[model samples]
Target: MERSLSFRSVSILSPESANGRNVVALGVADAFARHGSTTIFRPSAASKDPFTRILLDAAESAIPLDDSIGVSPEVFRSHEMSMRADIVARYHHIIDARTLDSTVIVGTDKSPITDPEEFSLNAKIAADLQSPVFLAVCTLHRNPDELLATVHACEEAVDEAGSKVLGLFVTGCSPERREDTLNGLHELPYQVWTVPPQTVDPQSEDSIRQSLESFRQQVPADELIQASEEDWNIPVTPLQFQYSLLHQAKAHHKTIVLPEGEEDRIIQAADFLLARDIVDLIIVGERESILERGDALGLTQLHKASFQSPHDEELLAQMTTELCRLRSKKGMPEEQARKTLQDASYFGTMLVVLGKADGLVSGSINSTANTVRPALQAIKTKPGSSLVSGAFLMCFDTHVALFADCAINPNPNAQCLAEIAIQSAQTAQSFGIEPRIGMLSYSTLGSGKGPDVELVEEATKLLREQAPELQVVGPIQFDAAWSPQVAASKAQGDPVAGRVNVFVFPDLSAGNIAYKAVQRSSGALAVGPVLQGLNKPVNDLSRGAMVQDIINTVALTAAQAD
Candidate 1:
């Protein structure tokens, strides 16, 4: 059986006072509204408080706050059960007035820190409303075990109160203890998220929007949503695009191994990654040296990342044995495998191969070959792919495009070219870009002829024979592929002539020069050389990659992980 939505409504409640619950409510409501119509209702208060006005200003409310039948916070405190019944009645009244794809029910606010009696009140109200419940807890100043205990208590208490606990949101856990909190939560059987402390005050409309944006940037994209096909064409700044990449990584938490952890930029990137809880991380380096460098830079979150020396006695021995066993057909000896395990790139790649990590990001200080070789030896190309290729995601203000073979495969044959195009389209799809490929050449539909143009034309034929469902326009010049007027004059009446997002160059020289020129001259944010067709994601960074570049690459690597 197939279900479209796992739940039609969610009740965001708290067993106690959680500071960011309002912001969480807005973000979750906005997420559901993006795909379909969603209503926001708060029934515990008839007075239009700041949060209620914030919801109204955000255009998420089902009705006016004062119009809904709600109990006073004082009255609720005095008569908990009776007010809980009134709150449920108010929710039904508001929801019955409107038709919505989803509804977000904001439960009563806990005004006091020691409001012990209200622990199951929110849960019981949600149960009466027939909605699943999300528990938001203020985890400030709490250790990991203590935080986990609170979550378990909430789960059991909610269950006893006759409501299903949907998810857990922890706010304000210290960076020192966040890693442990997340690790412990991962052992549980449900979804748990560590949210950044809300920054903007929720009193005003502008601040409310800011708060929603903050939550959108930090947490997973619709963590409770199981499916959506909505497209938000909203334009974003470069910084926002980077945040989108981070958001994609956080949507599914993956563990990425960094082989160039000794580099300062890599260490700095790790700090950012771990601080944001974007992914679980493992850094292959001398733990002491890395932590010392991080401390010197005033980095607070590096301690949260798991660190491993390439030559750790137990790990090195285990990896060496595994490597020799994997390569015994090539007559690999124990001594040779052990020596290979000492190299950071090889060790990190082996971690991925042995299922200790999901993906590997390296080449910050090493050459591209040093990073790609080990992955090729152990991970190999993805099934059904003939060869590996790379694509640089060039992001503009409004949209992002793919510039391919930019940093891999110097001179691809026709077959290599076809595979590159196919793999790149798949890569674009995976990264949430709709692939409209333009096989770029010096010619526009044979307006100018050369061996290069002929090669692209042949590759286009092969691509059509293989993945005919792909949108492709080949043997086309850049002008025709990009500009509508130029396309009209050159390849008239062709659907894909001017609306292409994936650019496939004839060779590495064209791709490398083009992406760099666009990056430096046009000031586009170039985000890859994201290697595609790997069995597991292994991304290579430029030796001169900046801190921000490494951060984006690591996020992309995590997004690509299995």
Candidate 2:
């Protein structure tokens, strides 16, 4: 079951006197988005700068060009606070209706109001929104005393207006001087984070995302903040993707049966998942071996584990009988079934078939054939799915794309390729990606002729006739599939020609090699080989998988069970 989202809001104010206020605002919005908050950024009344537009775009928020108004800066700052608040309120109303959780960040004018009377109006605006005010204070190469005075002014200004100060954003700190400036505010009671000065391309998505993660970590957990901290140990996958998997897995609370339970990485991942209450784990292996391995690794979280030995007599007998019944048409006998069930892959798959576990995740020490063959034999495909397929969730720092047929299907025909595309789109949707699919080939539309291009073109036609509601385009090359400008030149007015989040390959060799190349060359993280089309979820992990890899696969398996 999906959890209901609750709404929360916050606003940002800067010492109109501060330099780099725009940079600070961008950093804060990024922080909110990174933490899984649907963020809405409303520029200050005086903010019509290009950087502000770029910043909003980076945050995936847009303030319409029609909202841009030409007003005298002095008059706008004087009485426009109420009107600006109303505009923000309207945006909040619309966003809150559409989303369960969100953050609204209202930017402040360039200069802090110098007069005490004007400062009171600023506070009233904060009060009107009923949100805690986050003050962005850029040192501007000021002395310690000047910075301290600015902080004092913010504290007093929010306090006087019946509004609360959420925290202080310290920006424009030279990398070497960051600690020195932060230390100067040791006496301040509110939260403080020193944002690194922006690079020449400060508005770059990757840079802003990293800074937001860093900034959000400085905030106290109790504060009205939403953001995730980056884990250096799991640098390949994005933290946001990890968080999404965990959130869904937690909601489902399904059981995952791990076949390579005694493997060190598998044991560690199982320990973490069980301890975190993300999944109910059942490890299939020799109980004593796993326990000893867990102990030697100092796995404190292993005490929470549940173990199942493949050699257990009752389980073996029951699974053997079921296997014989399922494969008997192929002339399998009871003895052969019993012997085959001795392998943990078959045994774990049996657990899902027998309704003892919701899903299975293997391939840690096994080959893809070893992990998948048993699943195909036992759990089989869903009612309408002809054959199983796999997808890799390719995650970059700020974006995620799905590459499909990467781990299965050596060479699918037009019909099989069409199925692969449709299945991959469903899989992408399951992971929260809106699937705009690209059926990739060497050609764009009818530009090239070859068996490969024909295969992709036929698959695209089949997909359109079968599921026209699906956003898809085919016989599209990689460049045109991804770049809108290139798409315009090659395949105009086709929705999926560009802006595609899902890529469907004609064959396994192409899918597998491309995802790996992108993973290796672009420093993008590839999570899975997530097996799809199974009646019950059973995923494979690379043999060189890390502890985090197992954890991710397990969570995804649990989520798929739902």
Candidate 3:
């Protein structure tokens, strides 16, 4: 039981409707600081987005400058990624340099919710930083649905911009509407907390105290970060998992087969893996082409292992017969099976099937469907597995988050979703993660309804019935699933509410979009679509994957073989 996703900075965004914007912003930051996080206060005017400050900074006087100086919007945006990364990395450095528990809380001018586009300065900054926003809205004069609508707007905007809505903070409401607003906001999938309106000066001790007290009373403290350090803890960050997986793979001296052995990246990875002695490798390709290419590329070390060609007479005949027998119900003919076995995907997979190699790794030069098809037809599914799914190991500075079904299952039924959840949990554990699974949806604990919500709700029930010993909770929003404060507000007493390490997305659309958003926006390292439910380990690769990505995938494939 390890906690997940600790960050160096947290930014809070207030909706346009929030009263006393500065007061609300500072109030939220104060609470984080009190909870052992060193809060760095960055005002929205100071953001890297020039237009953001220009459009919204009322307090700062604009300097009159000559019109000659200009940077084109296209040019500015092209450099936006690097600039945003530098800003976030700078904050991480400052936070790490200090011994204290620290975080940087920057204030945005208004909710990007009402902003015309999702790529606005505030939104882009949040997306680039992968910061979780605490959307502040006033509930005093608004209808419950009105507040809920605004919150949803913010949610869409942040999500589109590549960030997450951590929770909602409501201020200046009578107790009656307050309850209604809180309940209504919960209908959507985010946490709802309250902040007392600062009628007096925001800088005053009383105002600060009241803000801190309100947040403390409304949101339960997250104790994970405050817990004492221990020696037996599993590695928590996904980037860290690369090293950990490589280390684990080397311990047993496993063998992994590479189907795309002739690809430059595969050659480089094979050379590297061999040089490091992380695992034994059986590279499947035309022996002459591999030798010629390896010699040309100075990757002669690949000759260390006998080149495994799919066309080898004995191996081809064995694979064809086995494949035909495996697919006998489909009445696959010997000629058709023999032709299929000629494919490197099939040949490489059969290496694992025949126990010649521990696992298979491909797709560096193939489509996911192409790489996975052979495994599904040959190695087949594991015992108790209904269908195969995918998970991306998102590595951040403080922790690693597992995002599931991101690459498969477009829209699964309850049983399929449940199976994916269980498979994802097992996958996480194989990588040394103690899986506290979160079944994510737009609704939390029956607060809302629809076919989608019901699917997740039903899937959660199925998972509980299937694996009662697992720490699984669902029909929970992303915010409530990961943030301690938000979990307290919306899903108190649920074990998996705030401590989830495995996030099971409802559909491929949500999972794919979310994992990509977090990766691009937050600059986190994502390690897989670590194909789950296969009886033997066979991983597909992204065509554009880097050399290190290939190495990591190979290591993971070997680890999965265990």
Candidate 4:
């Protein structure tokens, strides 16, 4: 059953009560009979007041029992008032024994009581009943002592019974007295609810009924419930991404090389990836020194990985032999070649050539020219490819497109463009993209004229002749390459005009700017500068790249190596 609970107020200032008829107590007893568990109003009894002959008439009206329950006037004494009220009233009896099981209890002290002991006793009884105590106290602008005594009584009641004091309600205060009353109660733990003076006739029946109804609804139910903290998900921050990638070694698990290993950021990143179980890491440095540095940095828990210095004897010997074989006709001596191969880049390239690592990523601490020069010499280009080029995987959500030769072949000729187109197509296909080669230039079909247009057109022809199964179309503008309507109007018969996924740039200048423009303007994620046409996957890192960038490059290189 959905039980409803409400507050019942007792009028302490009734005309009959002021006239010494004890009508207020009678009214409280009447309320107890009706509500079953009503709060008694306690205001100060000013003197040894005498009961008038009219009290007998008021008492008769107060008794709500089905049959009369007789009680003597002596039982109405200060101590006896607590006991006799309980015995004569059904509501008081249920409340004192705590069997009522109602939700709220609002008690008001309407008149000023001089005896602190009596006030404390009454409050203790209410608190012991285990009902939420709502105390209403009257405040006069100048009587700070009365206010303090009442506040102390309320606090003592709560402490004595181990019950919560929800708040205090201040009544009979003037508008100017409101702020002082609030300030006086501020030191108490309970919230304060101020009752503004009701200037309209307080004895009016309609006003009394309306005030009582409003008071009943204002009683609080159960305490407010809060949301569980466990339901929230931790957001991923940039630092977390960097740390996870480094400690987990996700990049290395796929078999890629990282060039800058000993640096602070790199080591921290490695430690993070390792801690997160993201990837297996391989560092290219002296093993003993790397471990010591890791220990010093309090990354002692990180897993130690294999390291190979470029100056190692076996690597130098192998580099010497390979360089001698490749450049012997140019009169390069075995000792000179050995000394040159002592560089880390040459050593990393040898690791790739010897099938030790799937790919290599360098250039963080070295120039791109220095990093790629060793690979170009040692690994060489793929069969039938005269020049190497670069490509990027541009992704936004699930949509992926390839931008080629953006970082390599500054001014690719017809032949170089053809190779980049074909290679980019293959790379795109490898990454699960259906390659539709768009040989991008400044012109669409023959609508515009330029050397760039001629270069792209000639490359498209060469690509068709050499790789006939591949779809190739160009000398097309960027808009026509990506838009179906434009392609349909301008290059109607071309196979890869509008739906092109692989964009082959005419040269590095256009490719770099175009890819950056597309990335910045469209908010696309640029994934590569993947050095294609190498015998193995050996990519380069930007100098300002983060650890996650290193990890991603490694993963991409490993994917290509596979």
Clashes of each: 0, 4, 2, 18
Cα error, residue 229 of model 1, in Å, equals 17
Q: Write the per-residue lDDT of candidate 1 for residues 1-562, one digit (tens) a residue.
A: 1123533777788655556677677777777777666667675654767766565545455566675436777776776545654565466556554666777777776564366757676666666565667777777766677777888888876676556676777876555666777897887666777676664466555776677777776666666575222222333334445655776788768999998787899999999889878999999888889999999998999988888887678988888888887888899999999888878899999999889899999999999889988888788898898788889999764467899998779999888999999999988898777899999998988888778888999999999999999999998999899888999999999999988989999999999999999899988889988998899999999888998899999999988876
Q: Candidate 2, after superposition: displacement of residue 233 in Å?
A: 28
> Whose lDDT is higher: candidate 2's or candidate 3's?
2
Query: Pairing residues by index, what is the TM-score of model 1?
Result: 0.62
| Tens digits of per-residue lDDT for model 3, 1-562 | 1112443344566555344444445444444455553434342332244322221121121222111112223333345544444344343333433444434344444453354442345554554444556666676667887877777777777665556665666777655566666677667655566655555233355754555465556545452122211122222333335556676777767899998877999989888788778889998888888878888988857777657877789878888888888899999999998888767788888888888999988999889998888888888899888798989988874467799999868999999999998898888887767899999998878778999998899999999999998998889999999898999988988877999889999999999999999999998888888999989888888899988789889988888777
What TM-score, computed on C-alpha atoms, does each candidate reach?
Answer: 0.62, 0.65, 0.60, 0.53
Q: List the residue pairs that clash in candidate 1.
A: none
The CA lDDT of each predicted structure is: 0.78, 0.74, 0.70, 0.58
Best by the TM-score measure = 2
lDDT of 1: 0.78
lDDT of 4 by residue, 1-562 (tens): 1223433222222111121112223322333434443323222221222221122122233222221222222332345434423322333332333333122222222244344354444443343232344455656343756776766765665555334444555655566776777777678765554544432223455644444343334322221101101122222222222222232334345555555666655666567546645545567777777778888888853454557776578767876787888777777898888777667777677777776777787877877787788888878898987878889877642246789999878988899889999889888877657788888888888888877778888898999898999877777888899989988988887777888889988888989998889888976667678888888888887777666566556656756765
In TM-score terms, candidate 4 sits at: 0.53
How far off is model 2, as Cα RMSD? 16.7
Worst 10-residue lDDT window for candidate 1 reads: 227-236
Worst 10 residues of 2 by lDDT: 228-237
In candidate 3, list every pair of residues with a backbone clash.
38-102, 127-521
